[model samples]
Target: MKDRQLYQQILGITTPWFVAEVELDLEAEEVHVHLAHQQASWPCAECGKPCPLHDHQNERTWRHLDTCQYRTLLHAELPRTRCEEHGVRVVDIPWAESYGRFTALFERLVIDWLEAASQQAVADRMGLSWDEVHGIMQRAVKRGLKRREAEPIPYIGVDEKSFRKRHRYVTVVSDINRSRVLYVSEDRKQTSLDSFWGTLTEEQLDSIEGVAMDMWEPYIDSTKEHLPEADEKIVFDKFHVAKHLGDAVDKVRRQENKQLREDGDDRLVGTKYDWLKGRDKFNHKRWRAFCRLRRSNLKTSRAWAMREQAMKLWDYCYPGAAENHFRWWYRWATHSRLEPMIDKAKMLKSHLKNILTYLTHPITNALSESLNSKIEWVKYTARGFRNRDNFKTAIYFHCGGLGLLPAT
Candidate 1:
């Protein structure tokens, strides 16, 4: 079929709706189209009044998909309608909004691309400005959010991620089993989670069996308050628990290092000092000064012994050995002469109930972390969303498991 005939078929205009005959030029790799309006009347959008259509007010054209290197243009003539309530206003078409010239399907394509790709890239490829592409994304996000509000989630995993270089952070909540985000709040405070509590029904809150979180007290307190009967069992993720022990070990090592420096032990100051630093390298550089103390002439056999004992806690040979290992560690730590290590061991034993829960259900907040990564991607693509409503919608559409397709 010819290009013009094919374009007409794609538009699907027959009799009742108005049609425009336009000529498209793609020699310059840019859209150029001339449209002639077909005289027709449209109803007022506000009051559904059968208002008389005025003369063609203006001709607007938008860049659409390129056909085999040929630029496509959607040209339309906008007309006004005289409504007694709304006065004189531009008529709204089912295919496009009042001020918009592109068809609904065309808008959907832009939004889908925006979701997956960066705004600057989408704008350059579609021959549109960055603001135009962002606007379409904003609209799509709103529509998606509205659809998601119809259904609510039961089990939610709440966690926080850094938004800035320092301590500034944001909270994100997701469905643990479904593996989708439920909501994201601007701040990591209890108030942020409180704001979303209104959106959840009482039955939904009651259905939540357990909530996986870090050692943050605010999160635990808020969860308990909101989900009063929700198992009341907080599973402190293994990673966070391990991190605490690691920090304590480093602290003791630092104290021992200062005492060794007083005795002028220069041999313990350089490399080949793996024993003092331990295996975890996340904060190795910060704790290097303490690692040197391991070789100090000062009495540090107790500190060294505690470090080795702490490392042994992670040693689980098989599936059934976890309980036995926990019991063994309990006995060993309590009998130790080192007070600091004994204190930490006692704290661990106090939380043994929640710690052993991991053996029954070995799930962590890793799924929630994965969802936060996606949210970070969205923030980077748009360079941060100005509208909170639009941001929520975009998160829900992409991570809410709504299975929402683009407008087309």
Candidate 2:
């Protein structure tokens, strides 16, 4: 077969478009295929009304799939149509999308490579710059966001993650049941979460059964302002609750350790993890060692016990039973003679109404936590992002579960 015929078949050229010429430059190790239009006029891209051809656009070049060992490029002249209502615009082509510098097939290849590797790694492997690869990602995310359907999400999670050091953070909203990121915005303030709520319709917002998050006042205020019946729908995450308790216990340990050191007692030194770790986390020998530590009359022991008892309150099936159990633990915690425990107990009690809502929702930000772990990996893989927009784009591209390919 002739070279033009071979390239035409490989490119899948159909009517109204064909491979007019093929040039192989061995010195540059590139294959250039020139395309031509077969008709004098075509239908308007916007309204589908037939119009006369206006003129040929300037020569355009697009990177195509490599032909063997040579880099393949396509040269084309986009035909313009003079539409009466929509005015003159370039007609759409079959092989590529409008304003794109790569064929649809080549973009698909880039998307796959991006999913398998980091953006920088994919750019290095594909002989493309970082901006070119990121542009594809930007377009893919735009397409995916446009295609997402507004369905009722039964359970959702909202959390904050740092984009960089020095306390910079972004709020992330996710569909817990679907296990995908729904929205992301700068900062973790009330307005940051409010923007996500603004994206949902009234019906969609009404369909939300529960939202799991930490007891951040801004998030609470935002939800209370936007969502109907927000009291019942807001479920404080159990893990965040545990974190609070753990910090209280650690504080107790630190103060007691300082006092004991004055008296030459060193038992609490380097035993922070022993109190923080779950009871069963230690092996049999370590468990026995910790048992001896627990037997001592240590103030940290009382604090740790109170935290453990509070964690068990989550096992009750009904809110009434859970509330009763929590009250029992709360009384013990408040009276534990540790200032930190008293402070934490008071804080948790203030939010007790929503904390017990966990019985009905039984949902937590565990999935959101899991997604955050993946996001951390993404950041590490990229060697950290200098641009905040690029950081957000990377999260959506990797964790949004977006269908990020152009339709051919």
Candidate 3:
């Protein structure tokens, strides 16, 4: 086949465009393929109505995928058409999106590389600058966001993650049933989640049935403000509640250990994990050690028992039964003489309805937590993002599960 035909086939040029010429510069190790319009006049980019040729714009060059060992470039004369309805506008090209300096195929290759590797790695491998690679990613994310269909979210998990250090955070909302990130925005404030709710259509907002989240007031407030059935839909994650109880247990353990140290008693020494770890996770030796602690009169021992009993509250089939169990456990914890345990019990009492809402719909933020872990991995892989926008984009790109492939 001739060089022009080979170039045309390689570049996927067809219809309104074709590879008119090929210039192989061995000195520069580059392949320059010149493109030409097949017709003298074409449809307007704005209105899609065929119009007489206004004039041809200056030659524009787009970077293409490498040809074997050489860099490939495509040069074309972009035409402008004056539509009566719309003023003079440049006609759209077939092989590339408007205002893009790289061909669609090249951008597609970059998208695959970005999924597999970091932007820096891709830039290095492709001999492109870091900004160039980031631009490609930004454009790809824009395309993906545009292409994504906004379906009604029935079940969602809301959480916040640290973007950089010093308490910098971003709120992430995930479709729990679909196990994909639905929206992300800066800050852990109510406004952060408000942005997400604002984007949803009325039907989409009404379709939401459940939202699993940690006991963060901002998230709760946002849900109450936006969701019609906040009382019924809001579910405080079990793991988070368990975490508070666990923290209270550890606090009691630390205080007891300190008191024991003062009294010259070594009974609670080296037994931190005994109180925190689950009984099922204990080995024979650890179990024996925990048994000894359980039998002892340490305040931590009572706190541990209370924590275990509270975990059992989730085992009840009915929400009323669970609430009753929690109330009994709350009475025990509040009277246990452990300040931390009392505080945790009081907090749970305040949020009991949201906690028990879990029984009606057993949804957990496990998937959201899993997504946070993956986002952390993405952050670690990229050695941390310099800005919140990049961090948000990275999370969406990696965990959003957005279909990012370009049109063929």
Candidate 4:
């Protein structure tokens, strides 16, 4: 077969362009394919209007997919066009993306590998530098974000992830129903989320029905400032609420353990985990330790009971029943002589309406937590980023689910 025809078949060249020549350097271990345009007139890269050929630009080379063990390259001297409107500019190419030095096919492969591996791994496997791999991912994410669906997102989850020490954080706003990272900004402040809401259209803002988040005042304030029905929409996440309850129980355990130690009793020493163990989570060893505590009349034991019973508040099918149950539990906890538990009860009482919004929405920040875990893995695999922009890019590239692959 002719070299030109063979290259045309290999490179998927179509219409106004064809493989003009092919050169192979055995010593260099490279295949260079030259491309030529068949048409006499050149089209403007920006406007696509046919214009007179102004001049020939410098010959450019693009890295193509490797053929076997040898690197393949595409070389073309693109023509410039003098358009009446767009002025003199280089005409577009068929095989490579504009302003990119790599073929689209090569970039697509890089994107695919990026989904399964880190940028460093992909770079090492593909004989590219770390910056090159990062650039590929950044470009893919840009394309994906440009093409992202504009349909209304009703439910969302907002949270923050620390990318560096010293509380360097980014607020992530994610679609709860779609389970996709929709926006990321460089802080957990009200302005961080305000920036996200600022990008939304009035119709889009009005479409928001619920937002599940932790008890961060900034997030609550931002939602209230932007959303139409913030009171009915903001939902305090169940997991974060449970964490507060657990912290209160641990505080009670610490206090009681301190008193017992003063009384020369070492029974509660090294038993902190015992007080936090869930009712159904105890194994044989933890069960025995907890059983020992259950037999005692310790304040920690009473606090643990209150913590476990608070779990029942989420089980009620109706909002009114859950409200009544929570109120009764609140009264018992506040008067039980346990200051930490009483404080937690008061905190929950303050956010009681937002807590009950859970019954109406049934949405949680579970997906955001899962995404945070994946983001942590990304950070670990990459050994942490040197800056915030790189960290944000890594998170959006991996957890954003942006459908970055090019169309076949």
Residue pairs that clash (backbone atoms under 3 angstroms), model 3: none
Report the lDDT tens digits of candidate 1 across residue range 1-408.
235455655555333343344554546755444344454566787888888776666667755555556766766666788877887877665456545556576787876776678778888988887668766755665566667653445446778766534475667787888888777787778887777677776766666666777767677678767777533456667766666665555555566667667988544344324444445752767466555544454334454555566445445445357667767876776776556667778878776656655544455687566676787786666454555544555576567765344443
**Per-residue C-alpha lDDT of model 3 across residues 283-322, encoded as one tens digit per residue:** 8997997797798887888888898898887787898888
TM-score of each: 0.68, 0.97, 0.95, 0.93
Question: Worst ten-residue run, lDDT, model 3?
Answer: 376-385
Error of 1 at 393 (Å): 6.6
TM-score of model 2 (CA atoms): 0.97
lDDT of 2 by residue, 217-330 (tens): 999999999999999999999999999999999999999999999999998999999898886788999889888887778899889888888898788888888888888988
- lDDT winner among the candidates? 2
Stretches off by above 4 angstroms in model 1 are 1-4, 10-15, 23-63, 67-71, 77-94, 97-102, 149-154, 231-233, 261-361, 372-398, 402-404
Clashes of each: 0, 0, 0, 0
Predictions ranked by lDDT, top down? 2, 3, 4, 1
Each prediction's whole-model lDDT (CA): 0.63, 0.89, 0.86, 0.85
Candidates, ranked, TM-score? 2, 3, 4, 1
lDDT of 1: 0.63
Q: Give candidate 3's total backbone clashes.
A: 0
Error of 4 at 260 (Å): 1.2
